[model samples]
Target: MKASRDDDPRVGLDGRLSWRPAGAADLDAWAALIARTAAVERPVWFERREDLAQILESRKNPTAGNSVLGFDVQGVARAYGRITKNPDGEKALGFGCVDPAWQGTGVGSGLLGWTEARTRQRFAADAATRAAARLRLFTEQQHTHHSALFEGRGYRIVRYYSEMHRPLDGTLPEPILDDGFELVPFGPELYEAVRQAHNDAFRDHWGSEPRDQEAWAFVVNDPLARPDLSAVVVERAGGKVAGYQLASHDAQSAESRGFTEGYTELLGVRPEFRGRGIARALLANAMRRFAAAGMDKAALDVDSENPTGALALYLKMGYVAVNSSMAWDREF
Candidate 1:
């Protein structure tokens, strides 16, 4: 089946529905669909209206690597998704929601097929780097249907992870900064140190790979990176370098998307600092920030089998397992 063109409506299954590239003109409809979809799948982490708008803006910018598409029935969108190729050109596609009003109408398959085609066109079109083309996404393990959809589309699970959360309504834990260790706010100045710490911290973990400094800089510099919510480290007594905790707010935006929950982007403690409660301290600090921001709940996705005891730590901190997802891939 041919994909829809930039100027054409995508006609699907018996011509009962159509899809097209989602644009600024479709913002209101897009927001409404997203809100309704989230309401139906409460507690799921989907993109916010503002984030969607930002994504649209990036797609229009051409130079930016974000692209989105929508499935419509007669002129109303019932399903939608996006493909985001980061600065490094690594690509991933995230999609969902069948309008309840149109679950098995072939809209879902069409959207998935189109998005995959676009992903291939974007990355595999270049002969010099076609082999580097890879598309990946995460789905809640509880989302059996959605997981099945991806599997049907030829995607395979590569790793498993969990979403964990903790509440901050009770007494705060006293943070212990080992002699010569101190907690600090992450800022532009600590970019290299933070990246170095992350590489060192996760080096031995399965699938862990060193990140390029420039790409790390772009991530930390992105407006959506949330500097205020990010955590870092310095020395104590005299101030040096130790470890870090990278957190961000998705719950606030999740509110706009019709939910409430914050996300812990990355939580890492230097190798030498493990077992000293530094990770817990960083988490407490993050929870404090979440509460201060008026969030009633917070969450983080973790490798379910992290060799470092991260998952157990989250459980001990009040983070009950709500949903789980796995990373899937196949030799390509």
Candidate 2:
């Protein structure tokens, strides 16, 4: 399913640049290109090599023919783009970047155009997605150039997200659960239960769709995932999973950023269990666990318009907004 170079959009953009489907051999170069591009905008987080590898090899969203890499004459990757259709067939997520040195040479535009075309091909190939499908991209609010690029292509901002951080130096709140609910450490045995709880909890969230078992496994089994730091709240009466806090630590990012931090990757409480202090308890427990693990801070991202009022809860927990990003969408 490799794309022929003759039809590549990068052909005229730069005579010395060649475009091809990215594969296992391009992992290192692709990661290096991503790091360089991210530095220009000072993103709040960085993607590790393992993270990129997992994405490239994911089972549910395979990148076999849905990704492209633009390499220089010297054989170094200078740009990359990938599109993945969600399992539910409602949207296609796109990610791409061009090296800072190659930014103005039309590389970014070529990569974006290719990604959009790929997205359309993917949607048309699937009967379920062709009727109501969209292509979504995310960029930090400060990246004005990125915004302009997407906007020029008929994309519009659909949602905003805030990255919040909280220092673990001060006294932390006690994880006080209600009488019927108790906090338990995350483990493999509770994986399915927690996954079900997560799906139910986020059913009403914007742009959220159910995660099949394969996708859920990929998340909980990630290399950076920290089971010891994660916590799940269960109802003692029926042993029902009421809430969960999934945490992860990236040593590479910590070292590069000069600060150790634990990321609360996903946190959710079942609708029926809301307002019973389950969410707060799960968060407090995660914060204390992170501090106990010697992390200097804890961080998480929340949609600015989350229906559950998560932003207000994070702010009340001493997390301050440090950065912001926007989700842009273009319908097919």
Which candidate leads the pack in TM-score?
Answer: 2
Residue-by-residue lDDT tens digits, candidate 1, 46-101:
55566556555452223123334454546776777666554334444445455767
Single out the weakest 10-residue window by summed lDDT for candidate 2: 6-15
What's model 2's TM-score? 0.93
Any idea what lDDT model 1 has? Answer: 0.66
Can you write out model 2's per-residue Cα lDDT over 195-300, one digit (the tens) per residue? 9999999999999988888789789979899999999999999999999999998887775678998999999999998988888888899899999999999999
**CA shift of 260, model 1, Å:** 6.4
**Regions of candidate 2 where Cα sits further than 4 Å from its true position:** 1-15
lDDT, residue 232, candidate 1: 75
Q: Give model 1's TM-score versus the native structure.
A: 0.75
Clashing pairs in 1: 141-324, 156-328, 157-328, 158-327, 158-328, 180-236, 235-240, 251-261
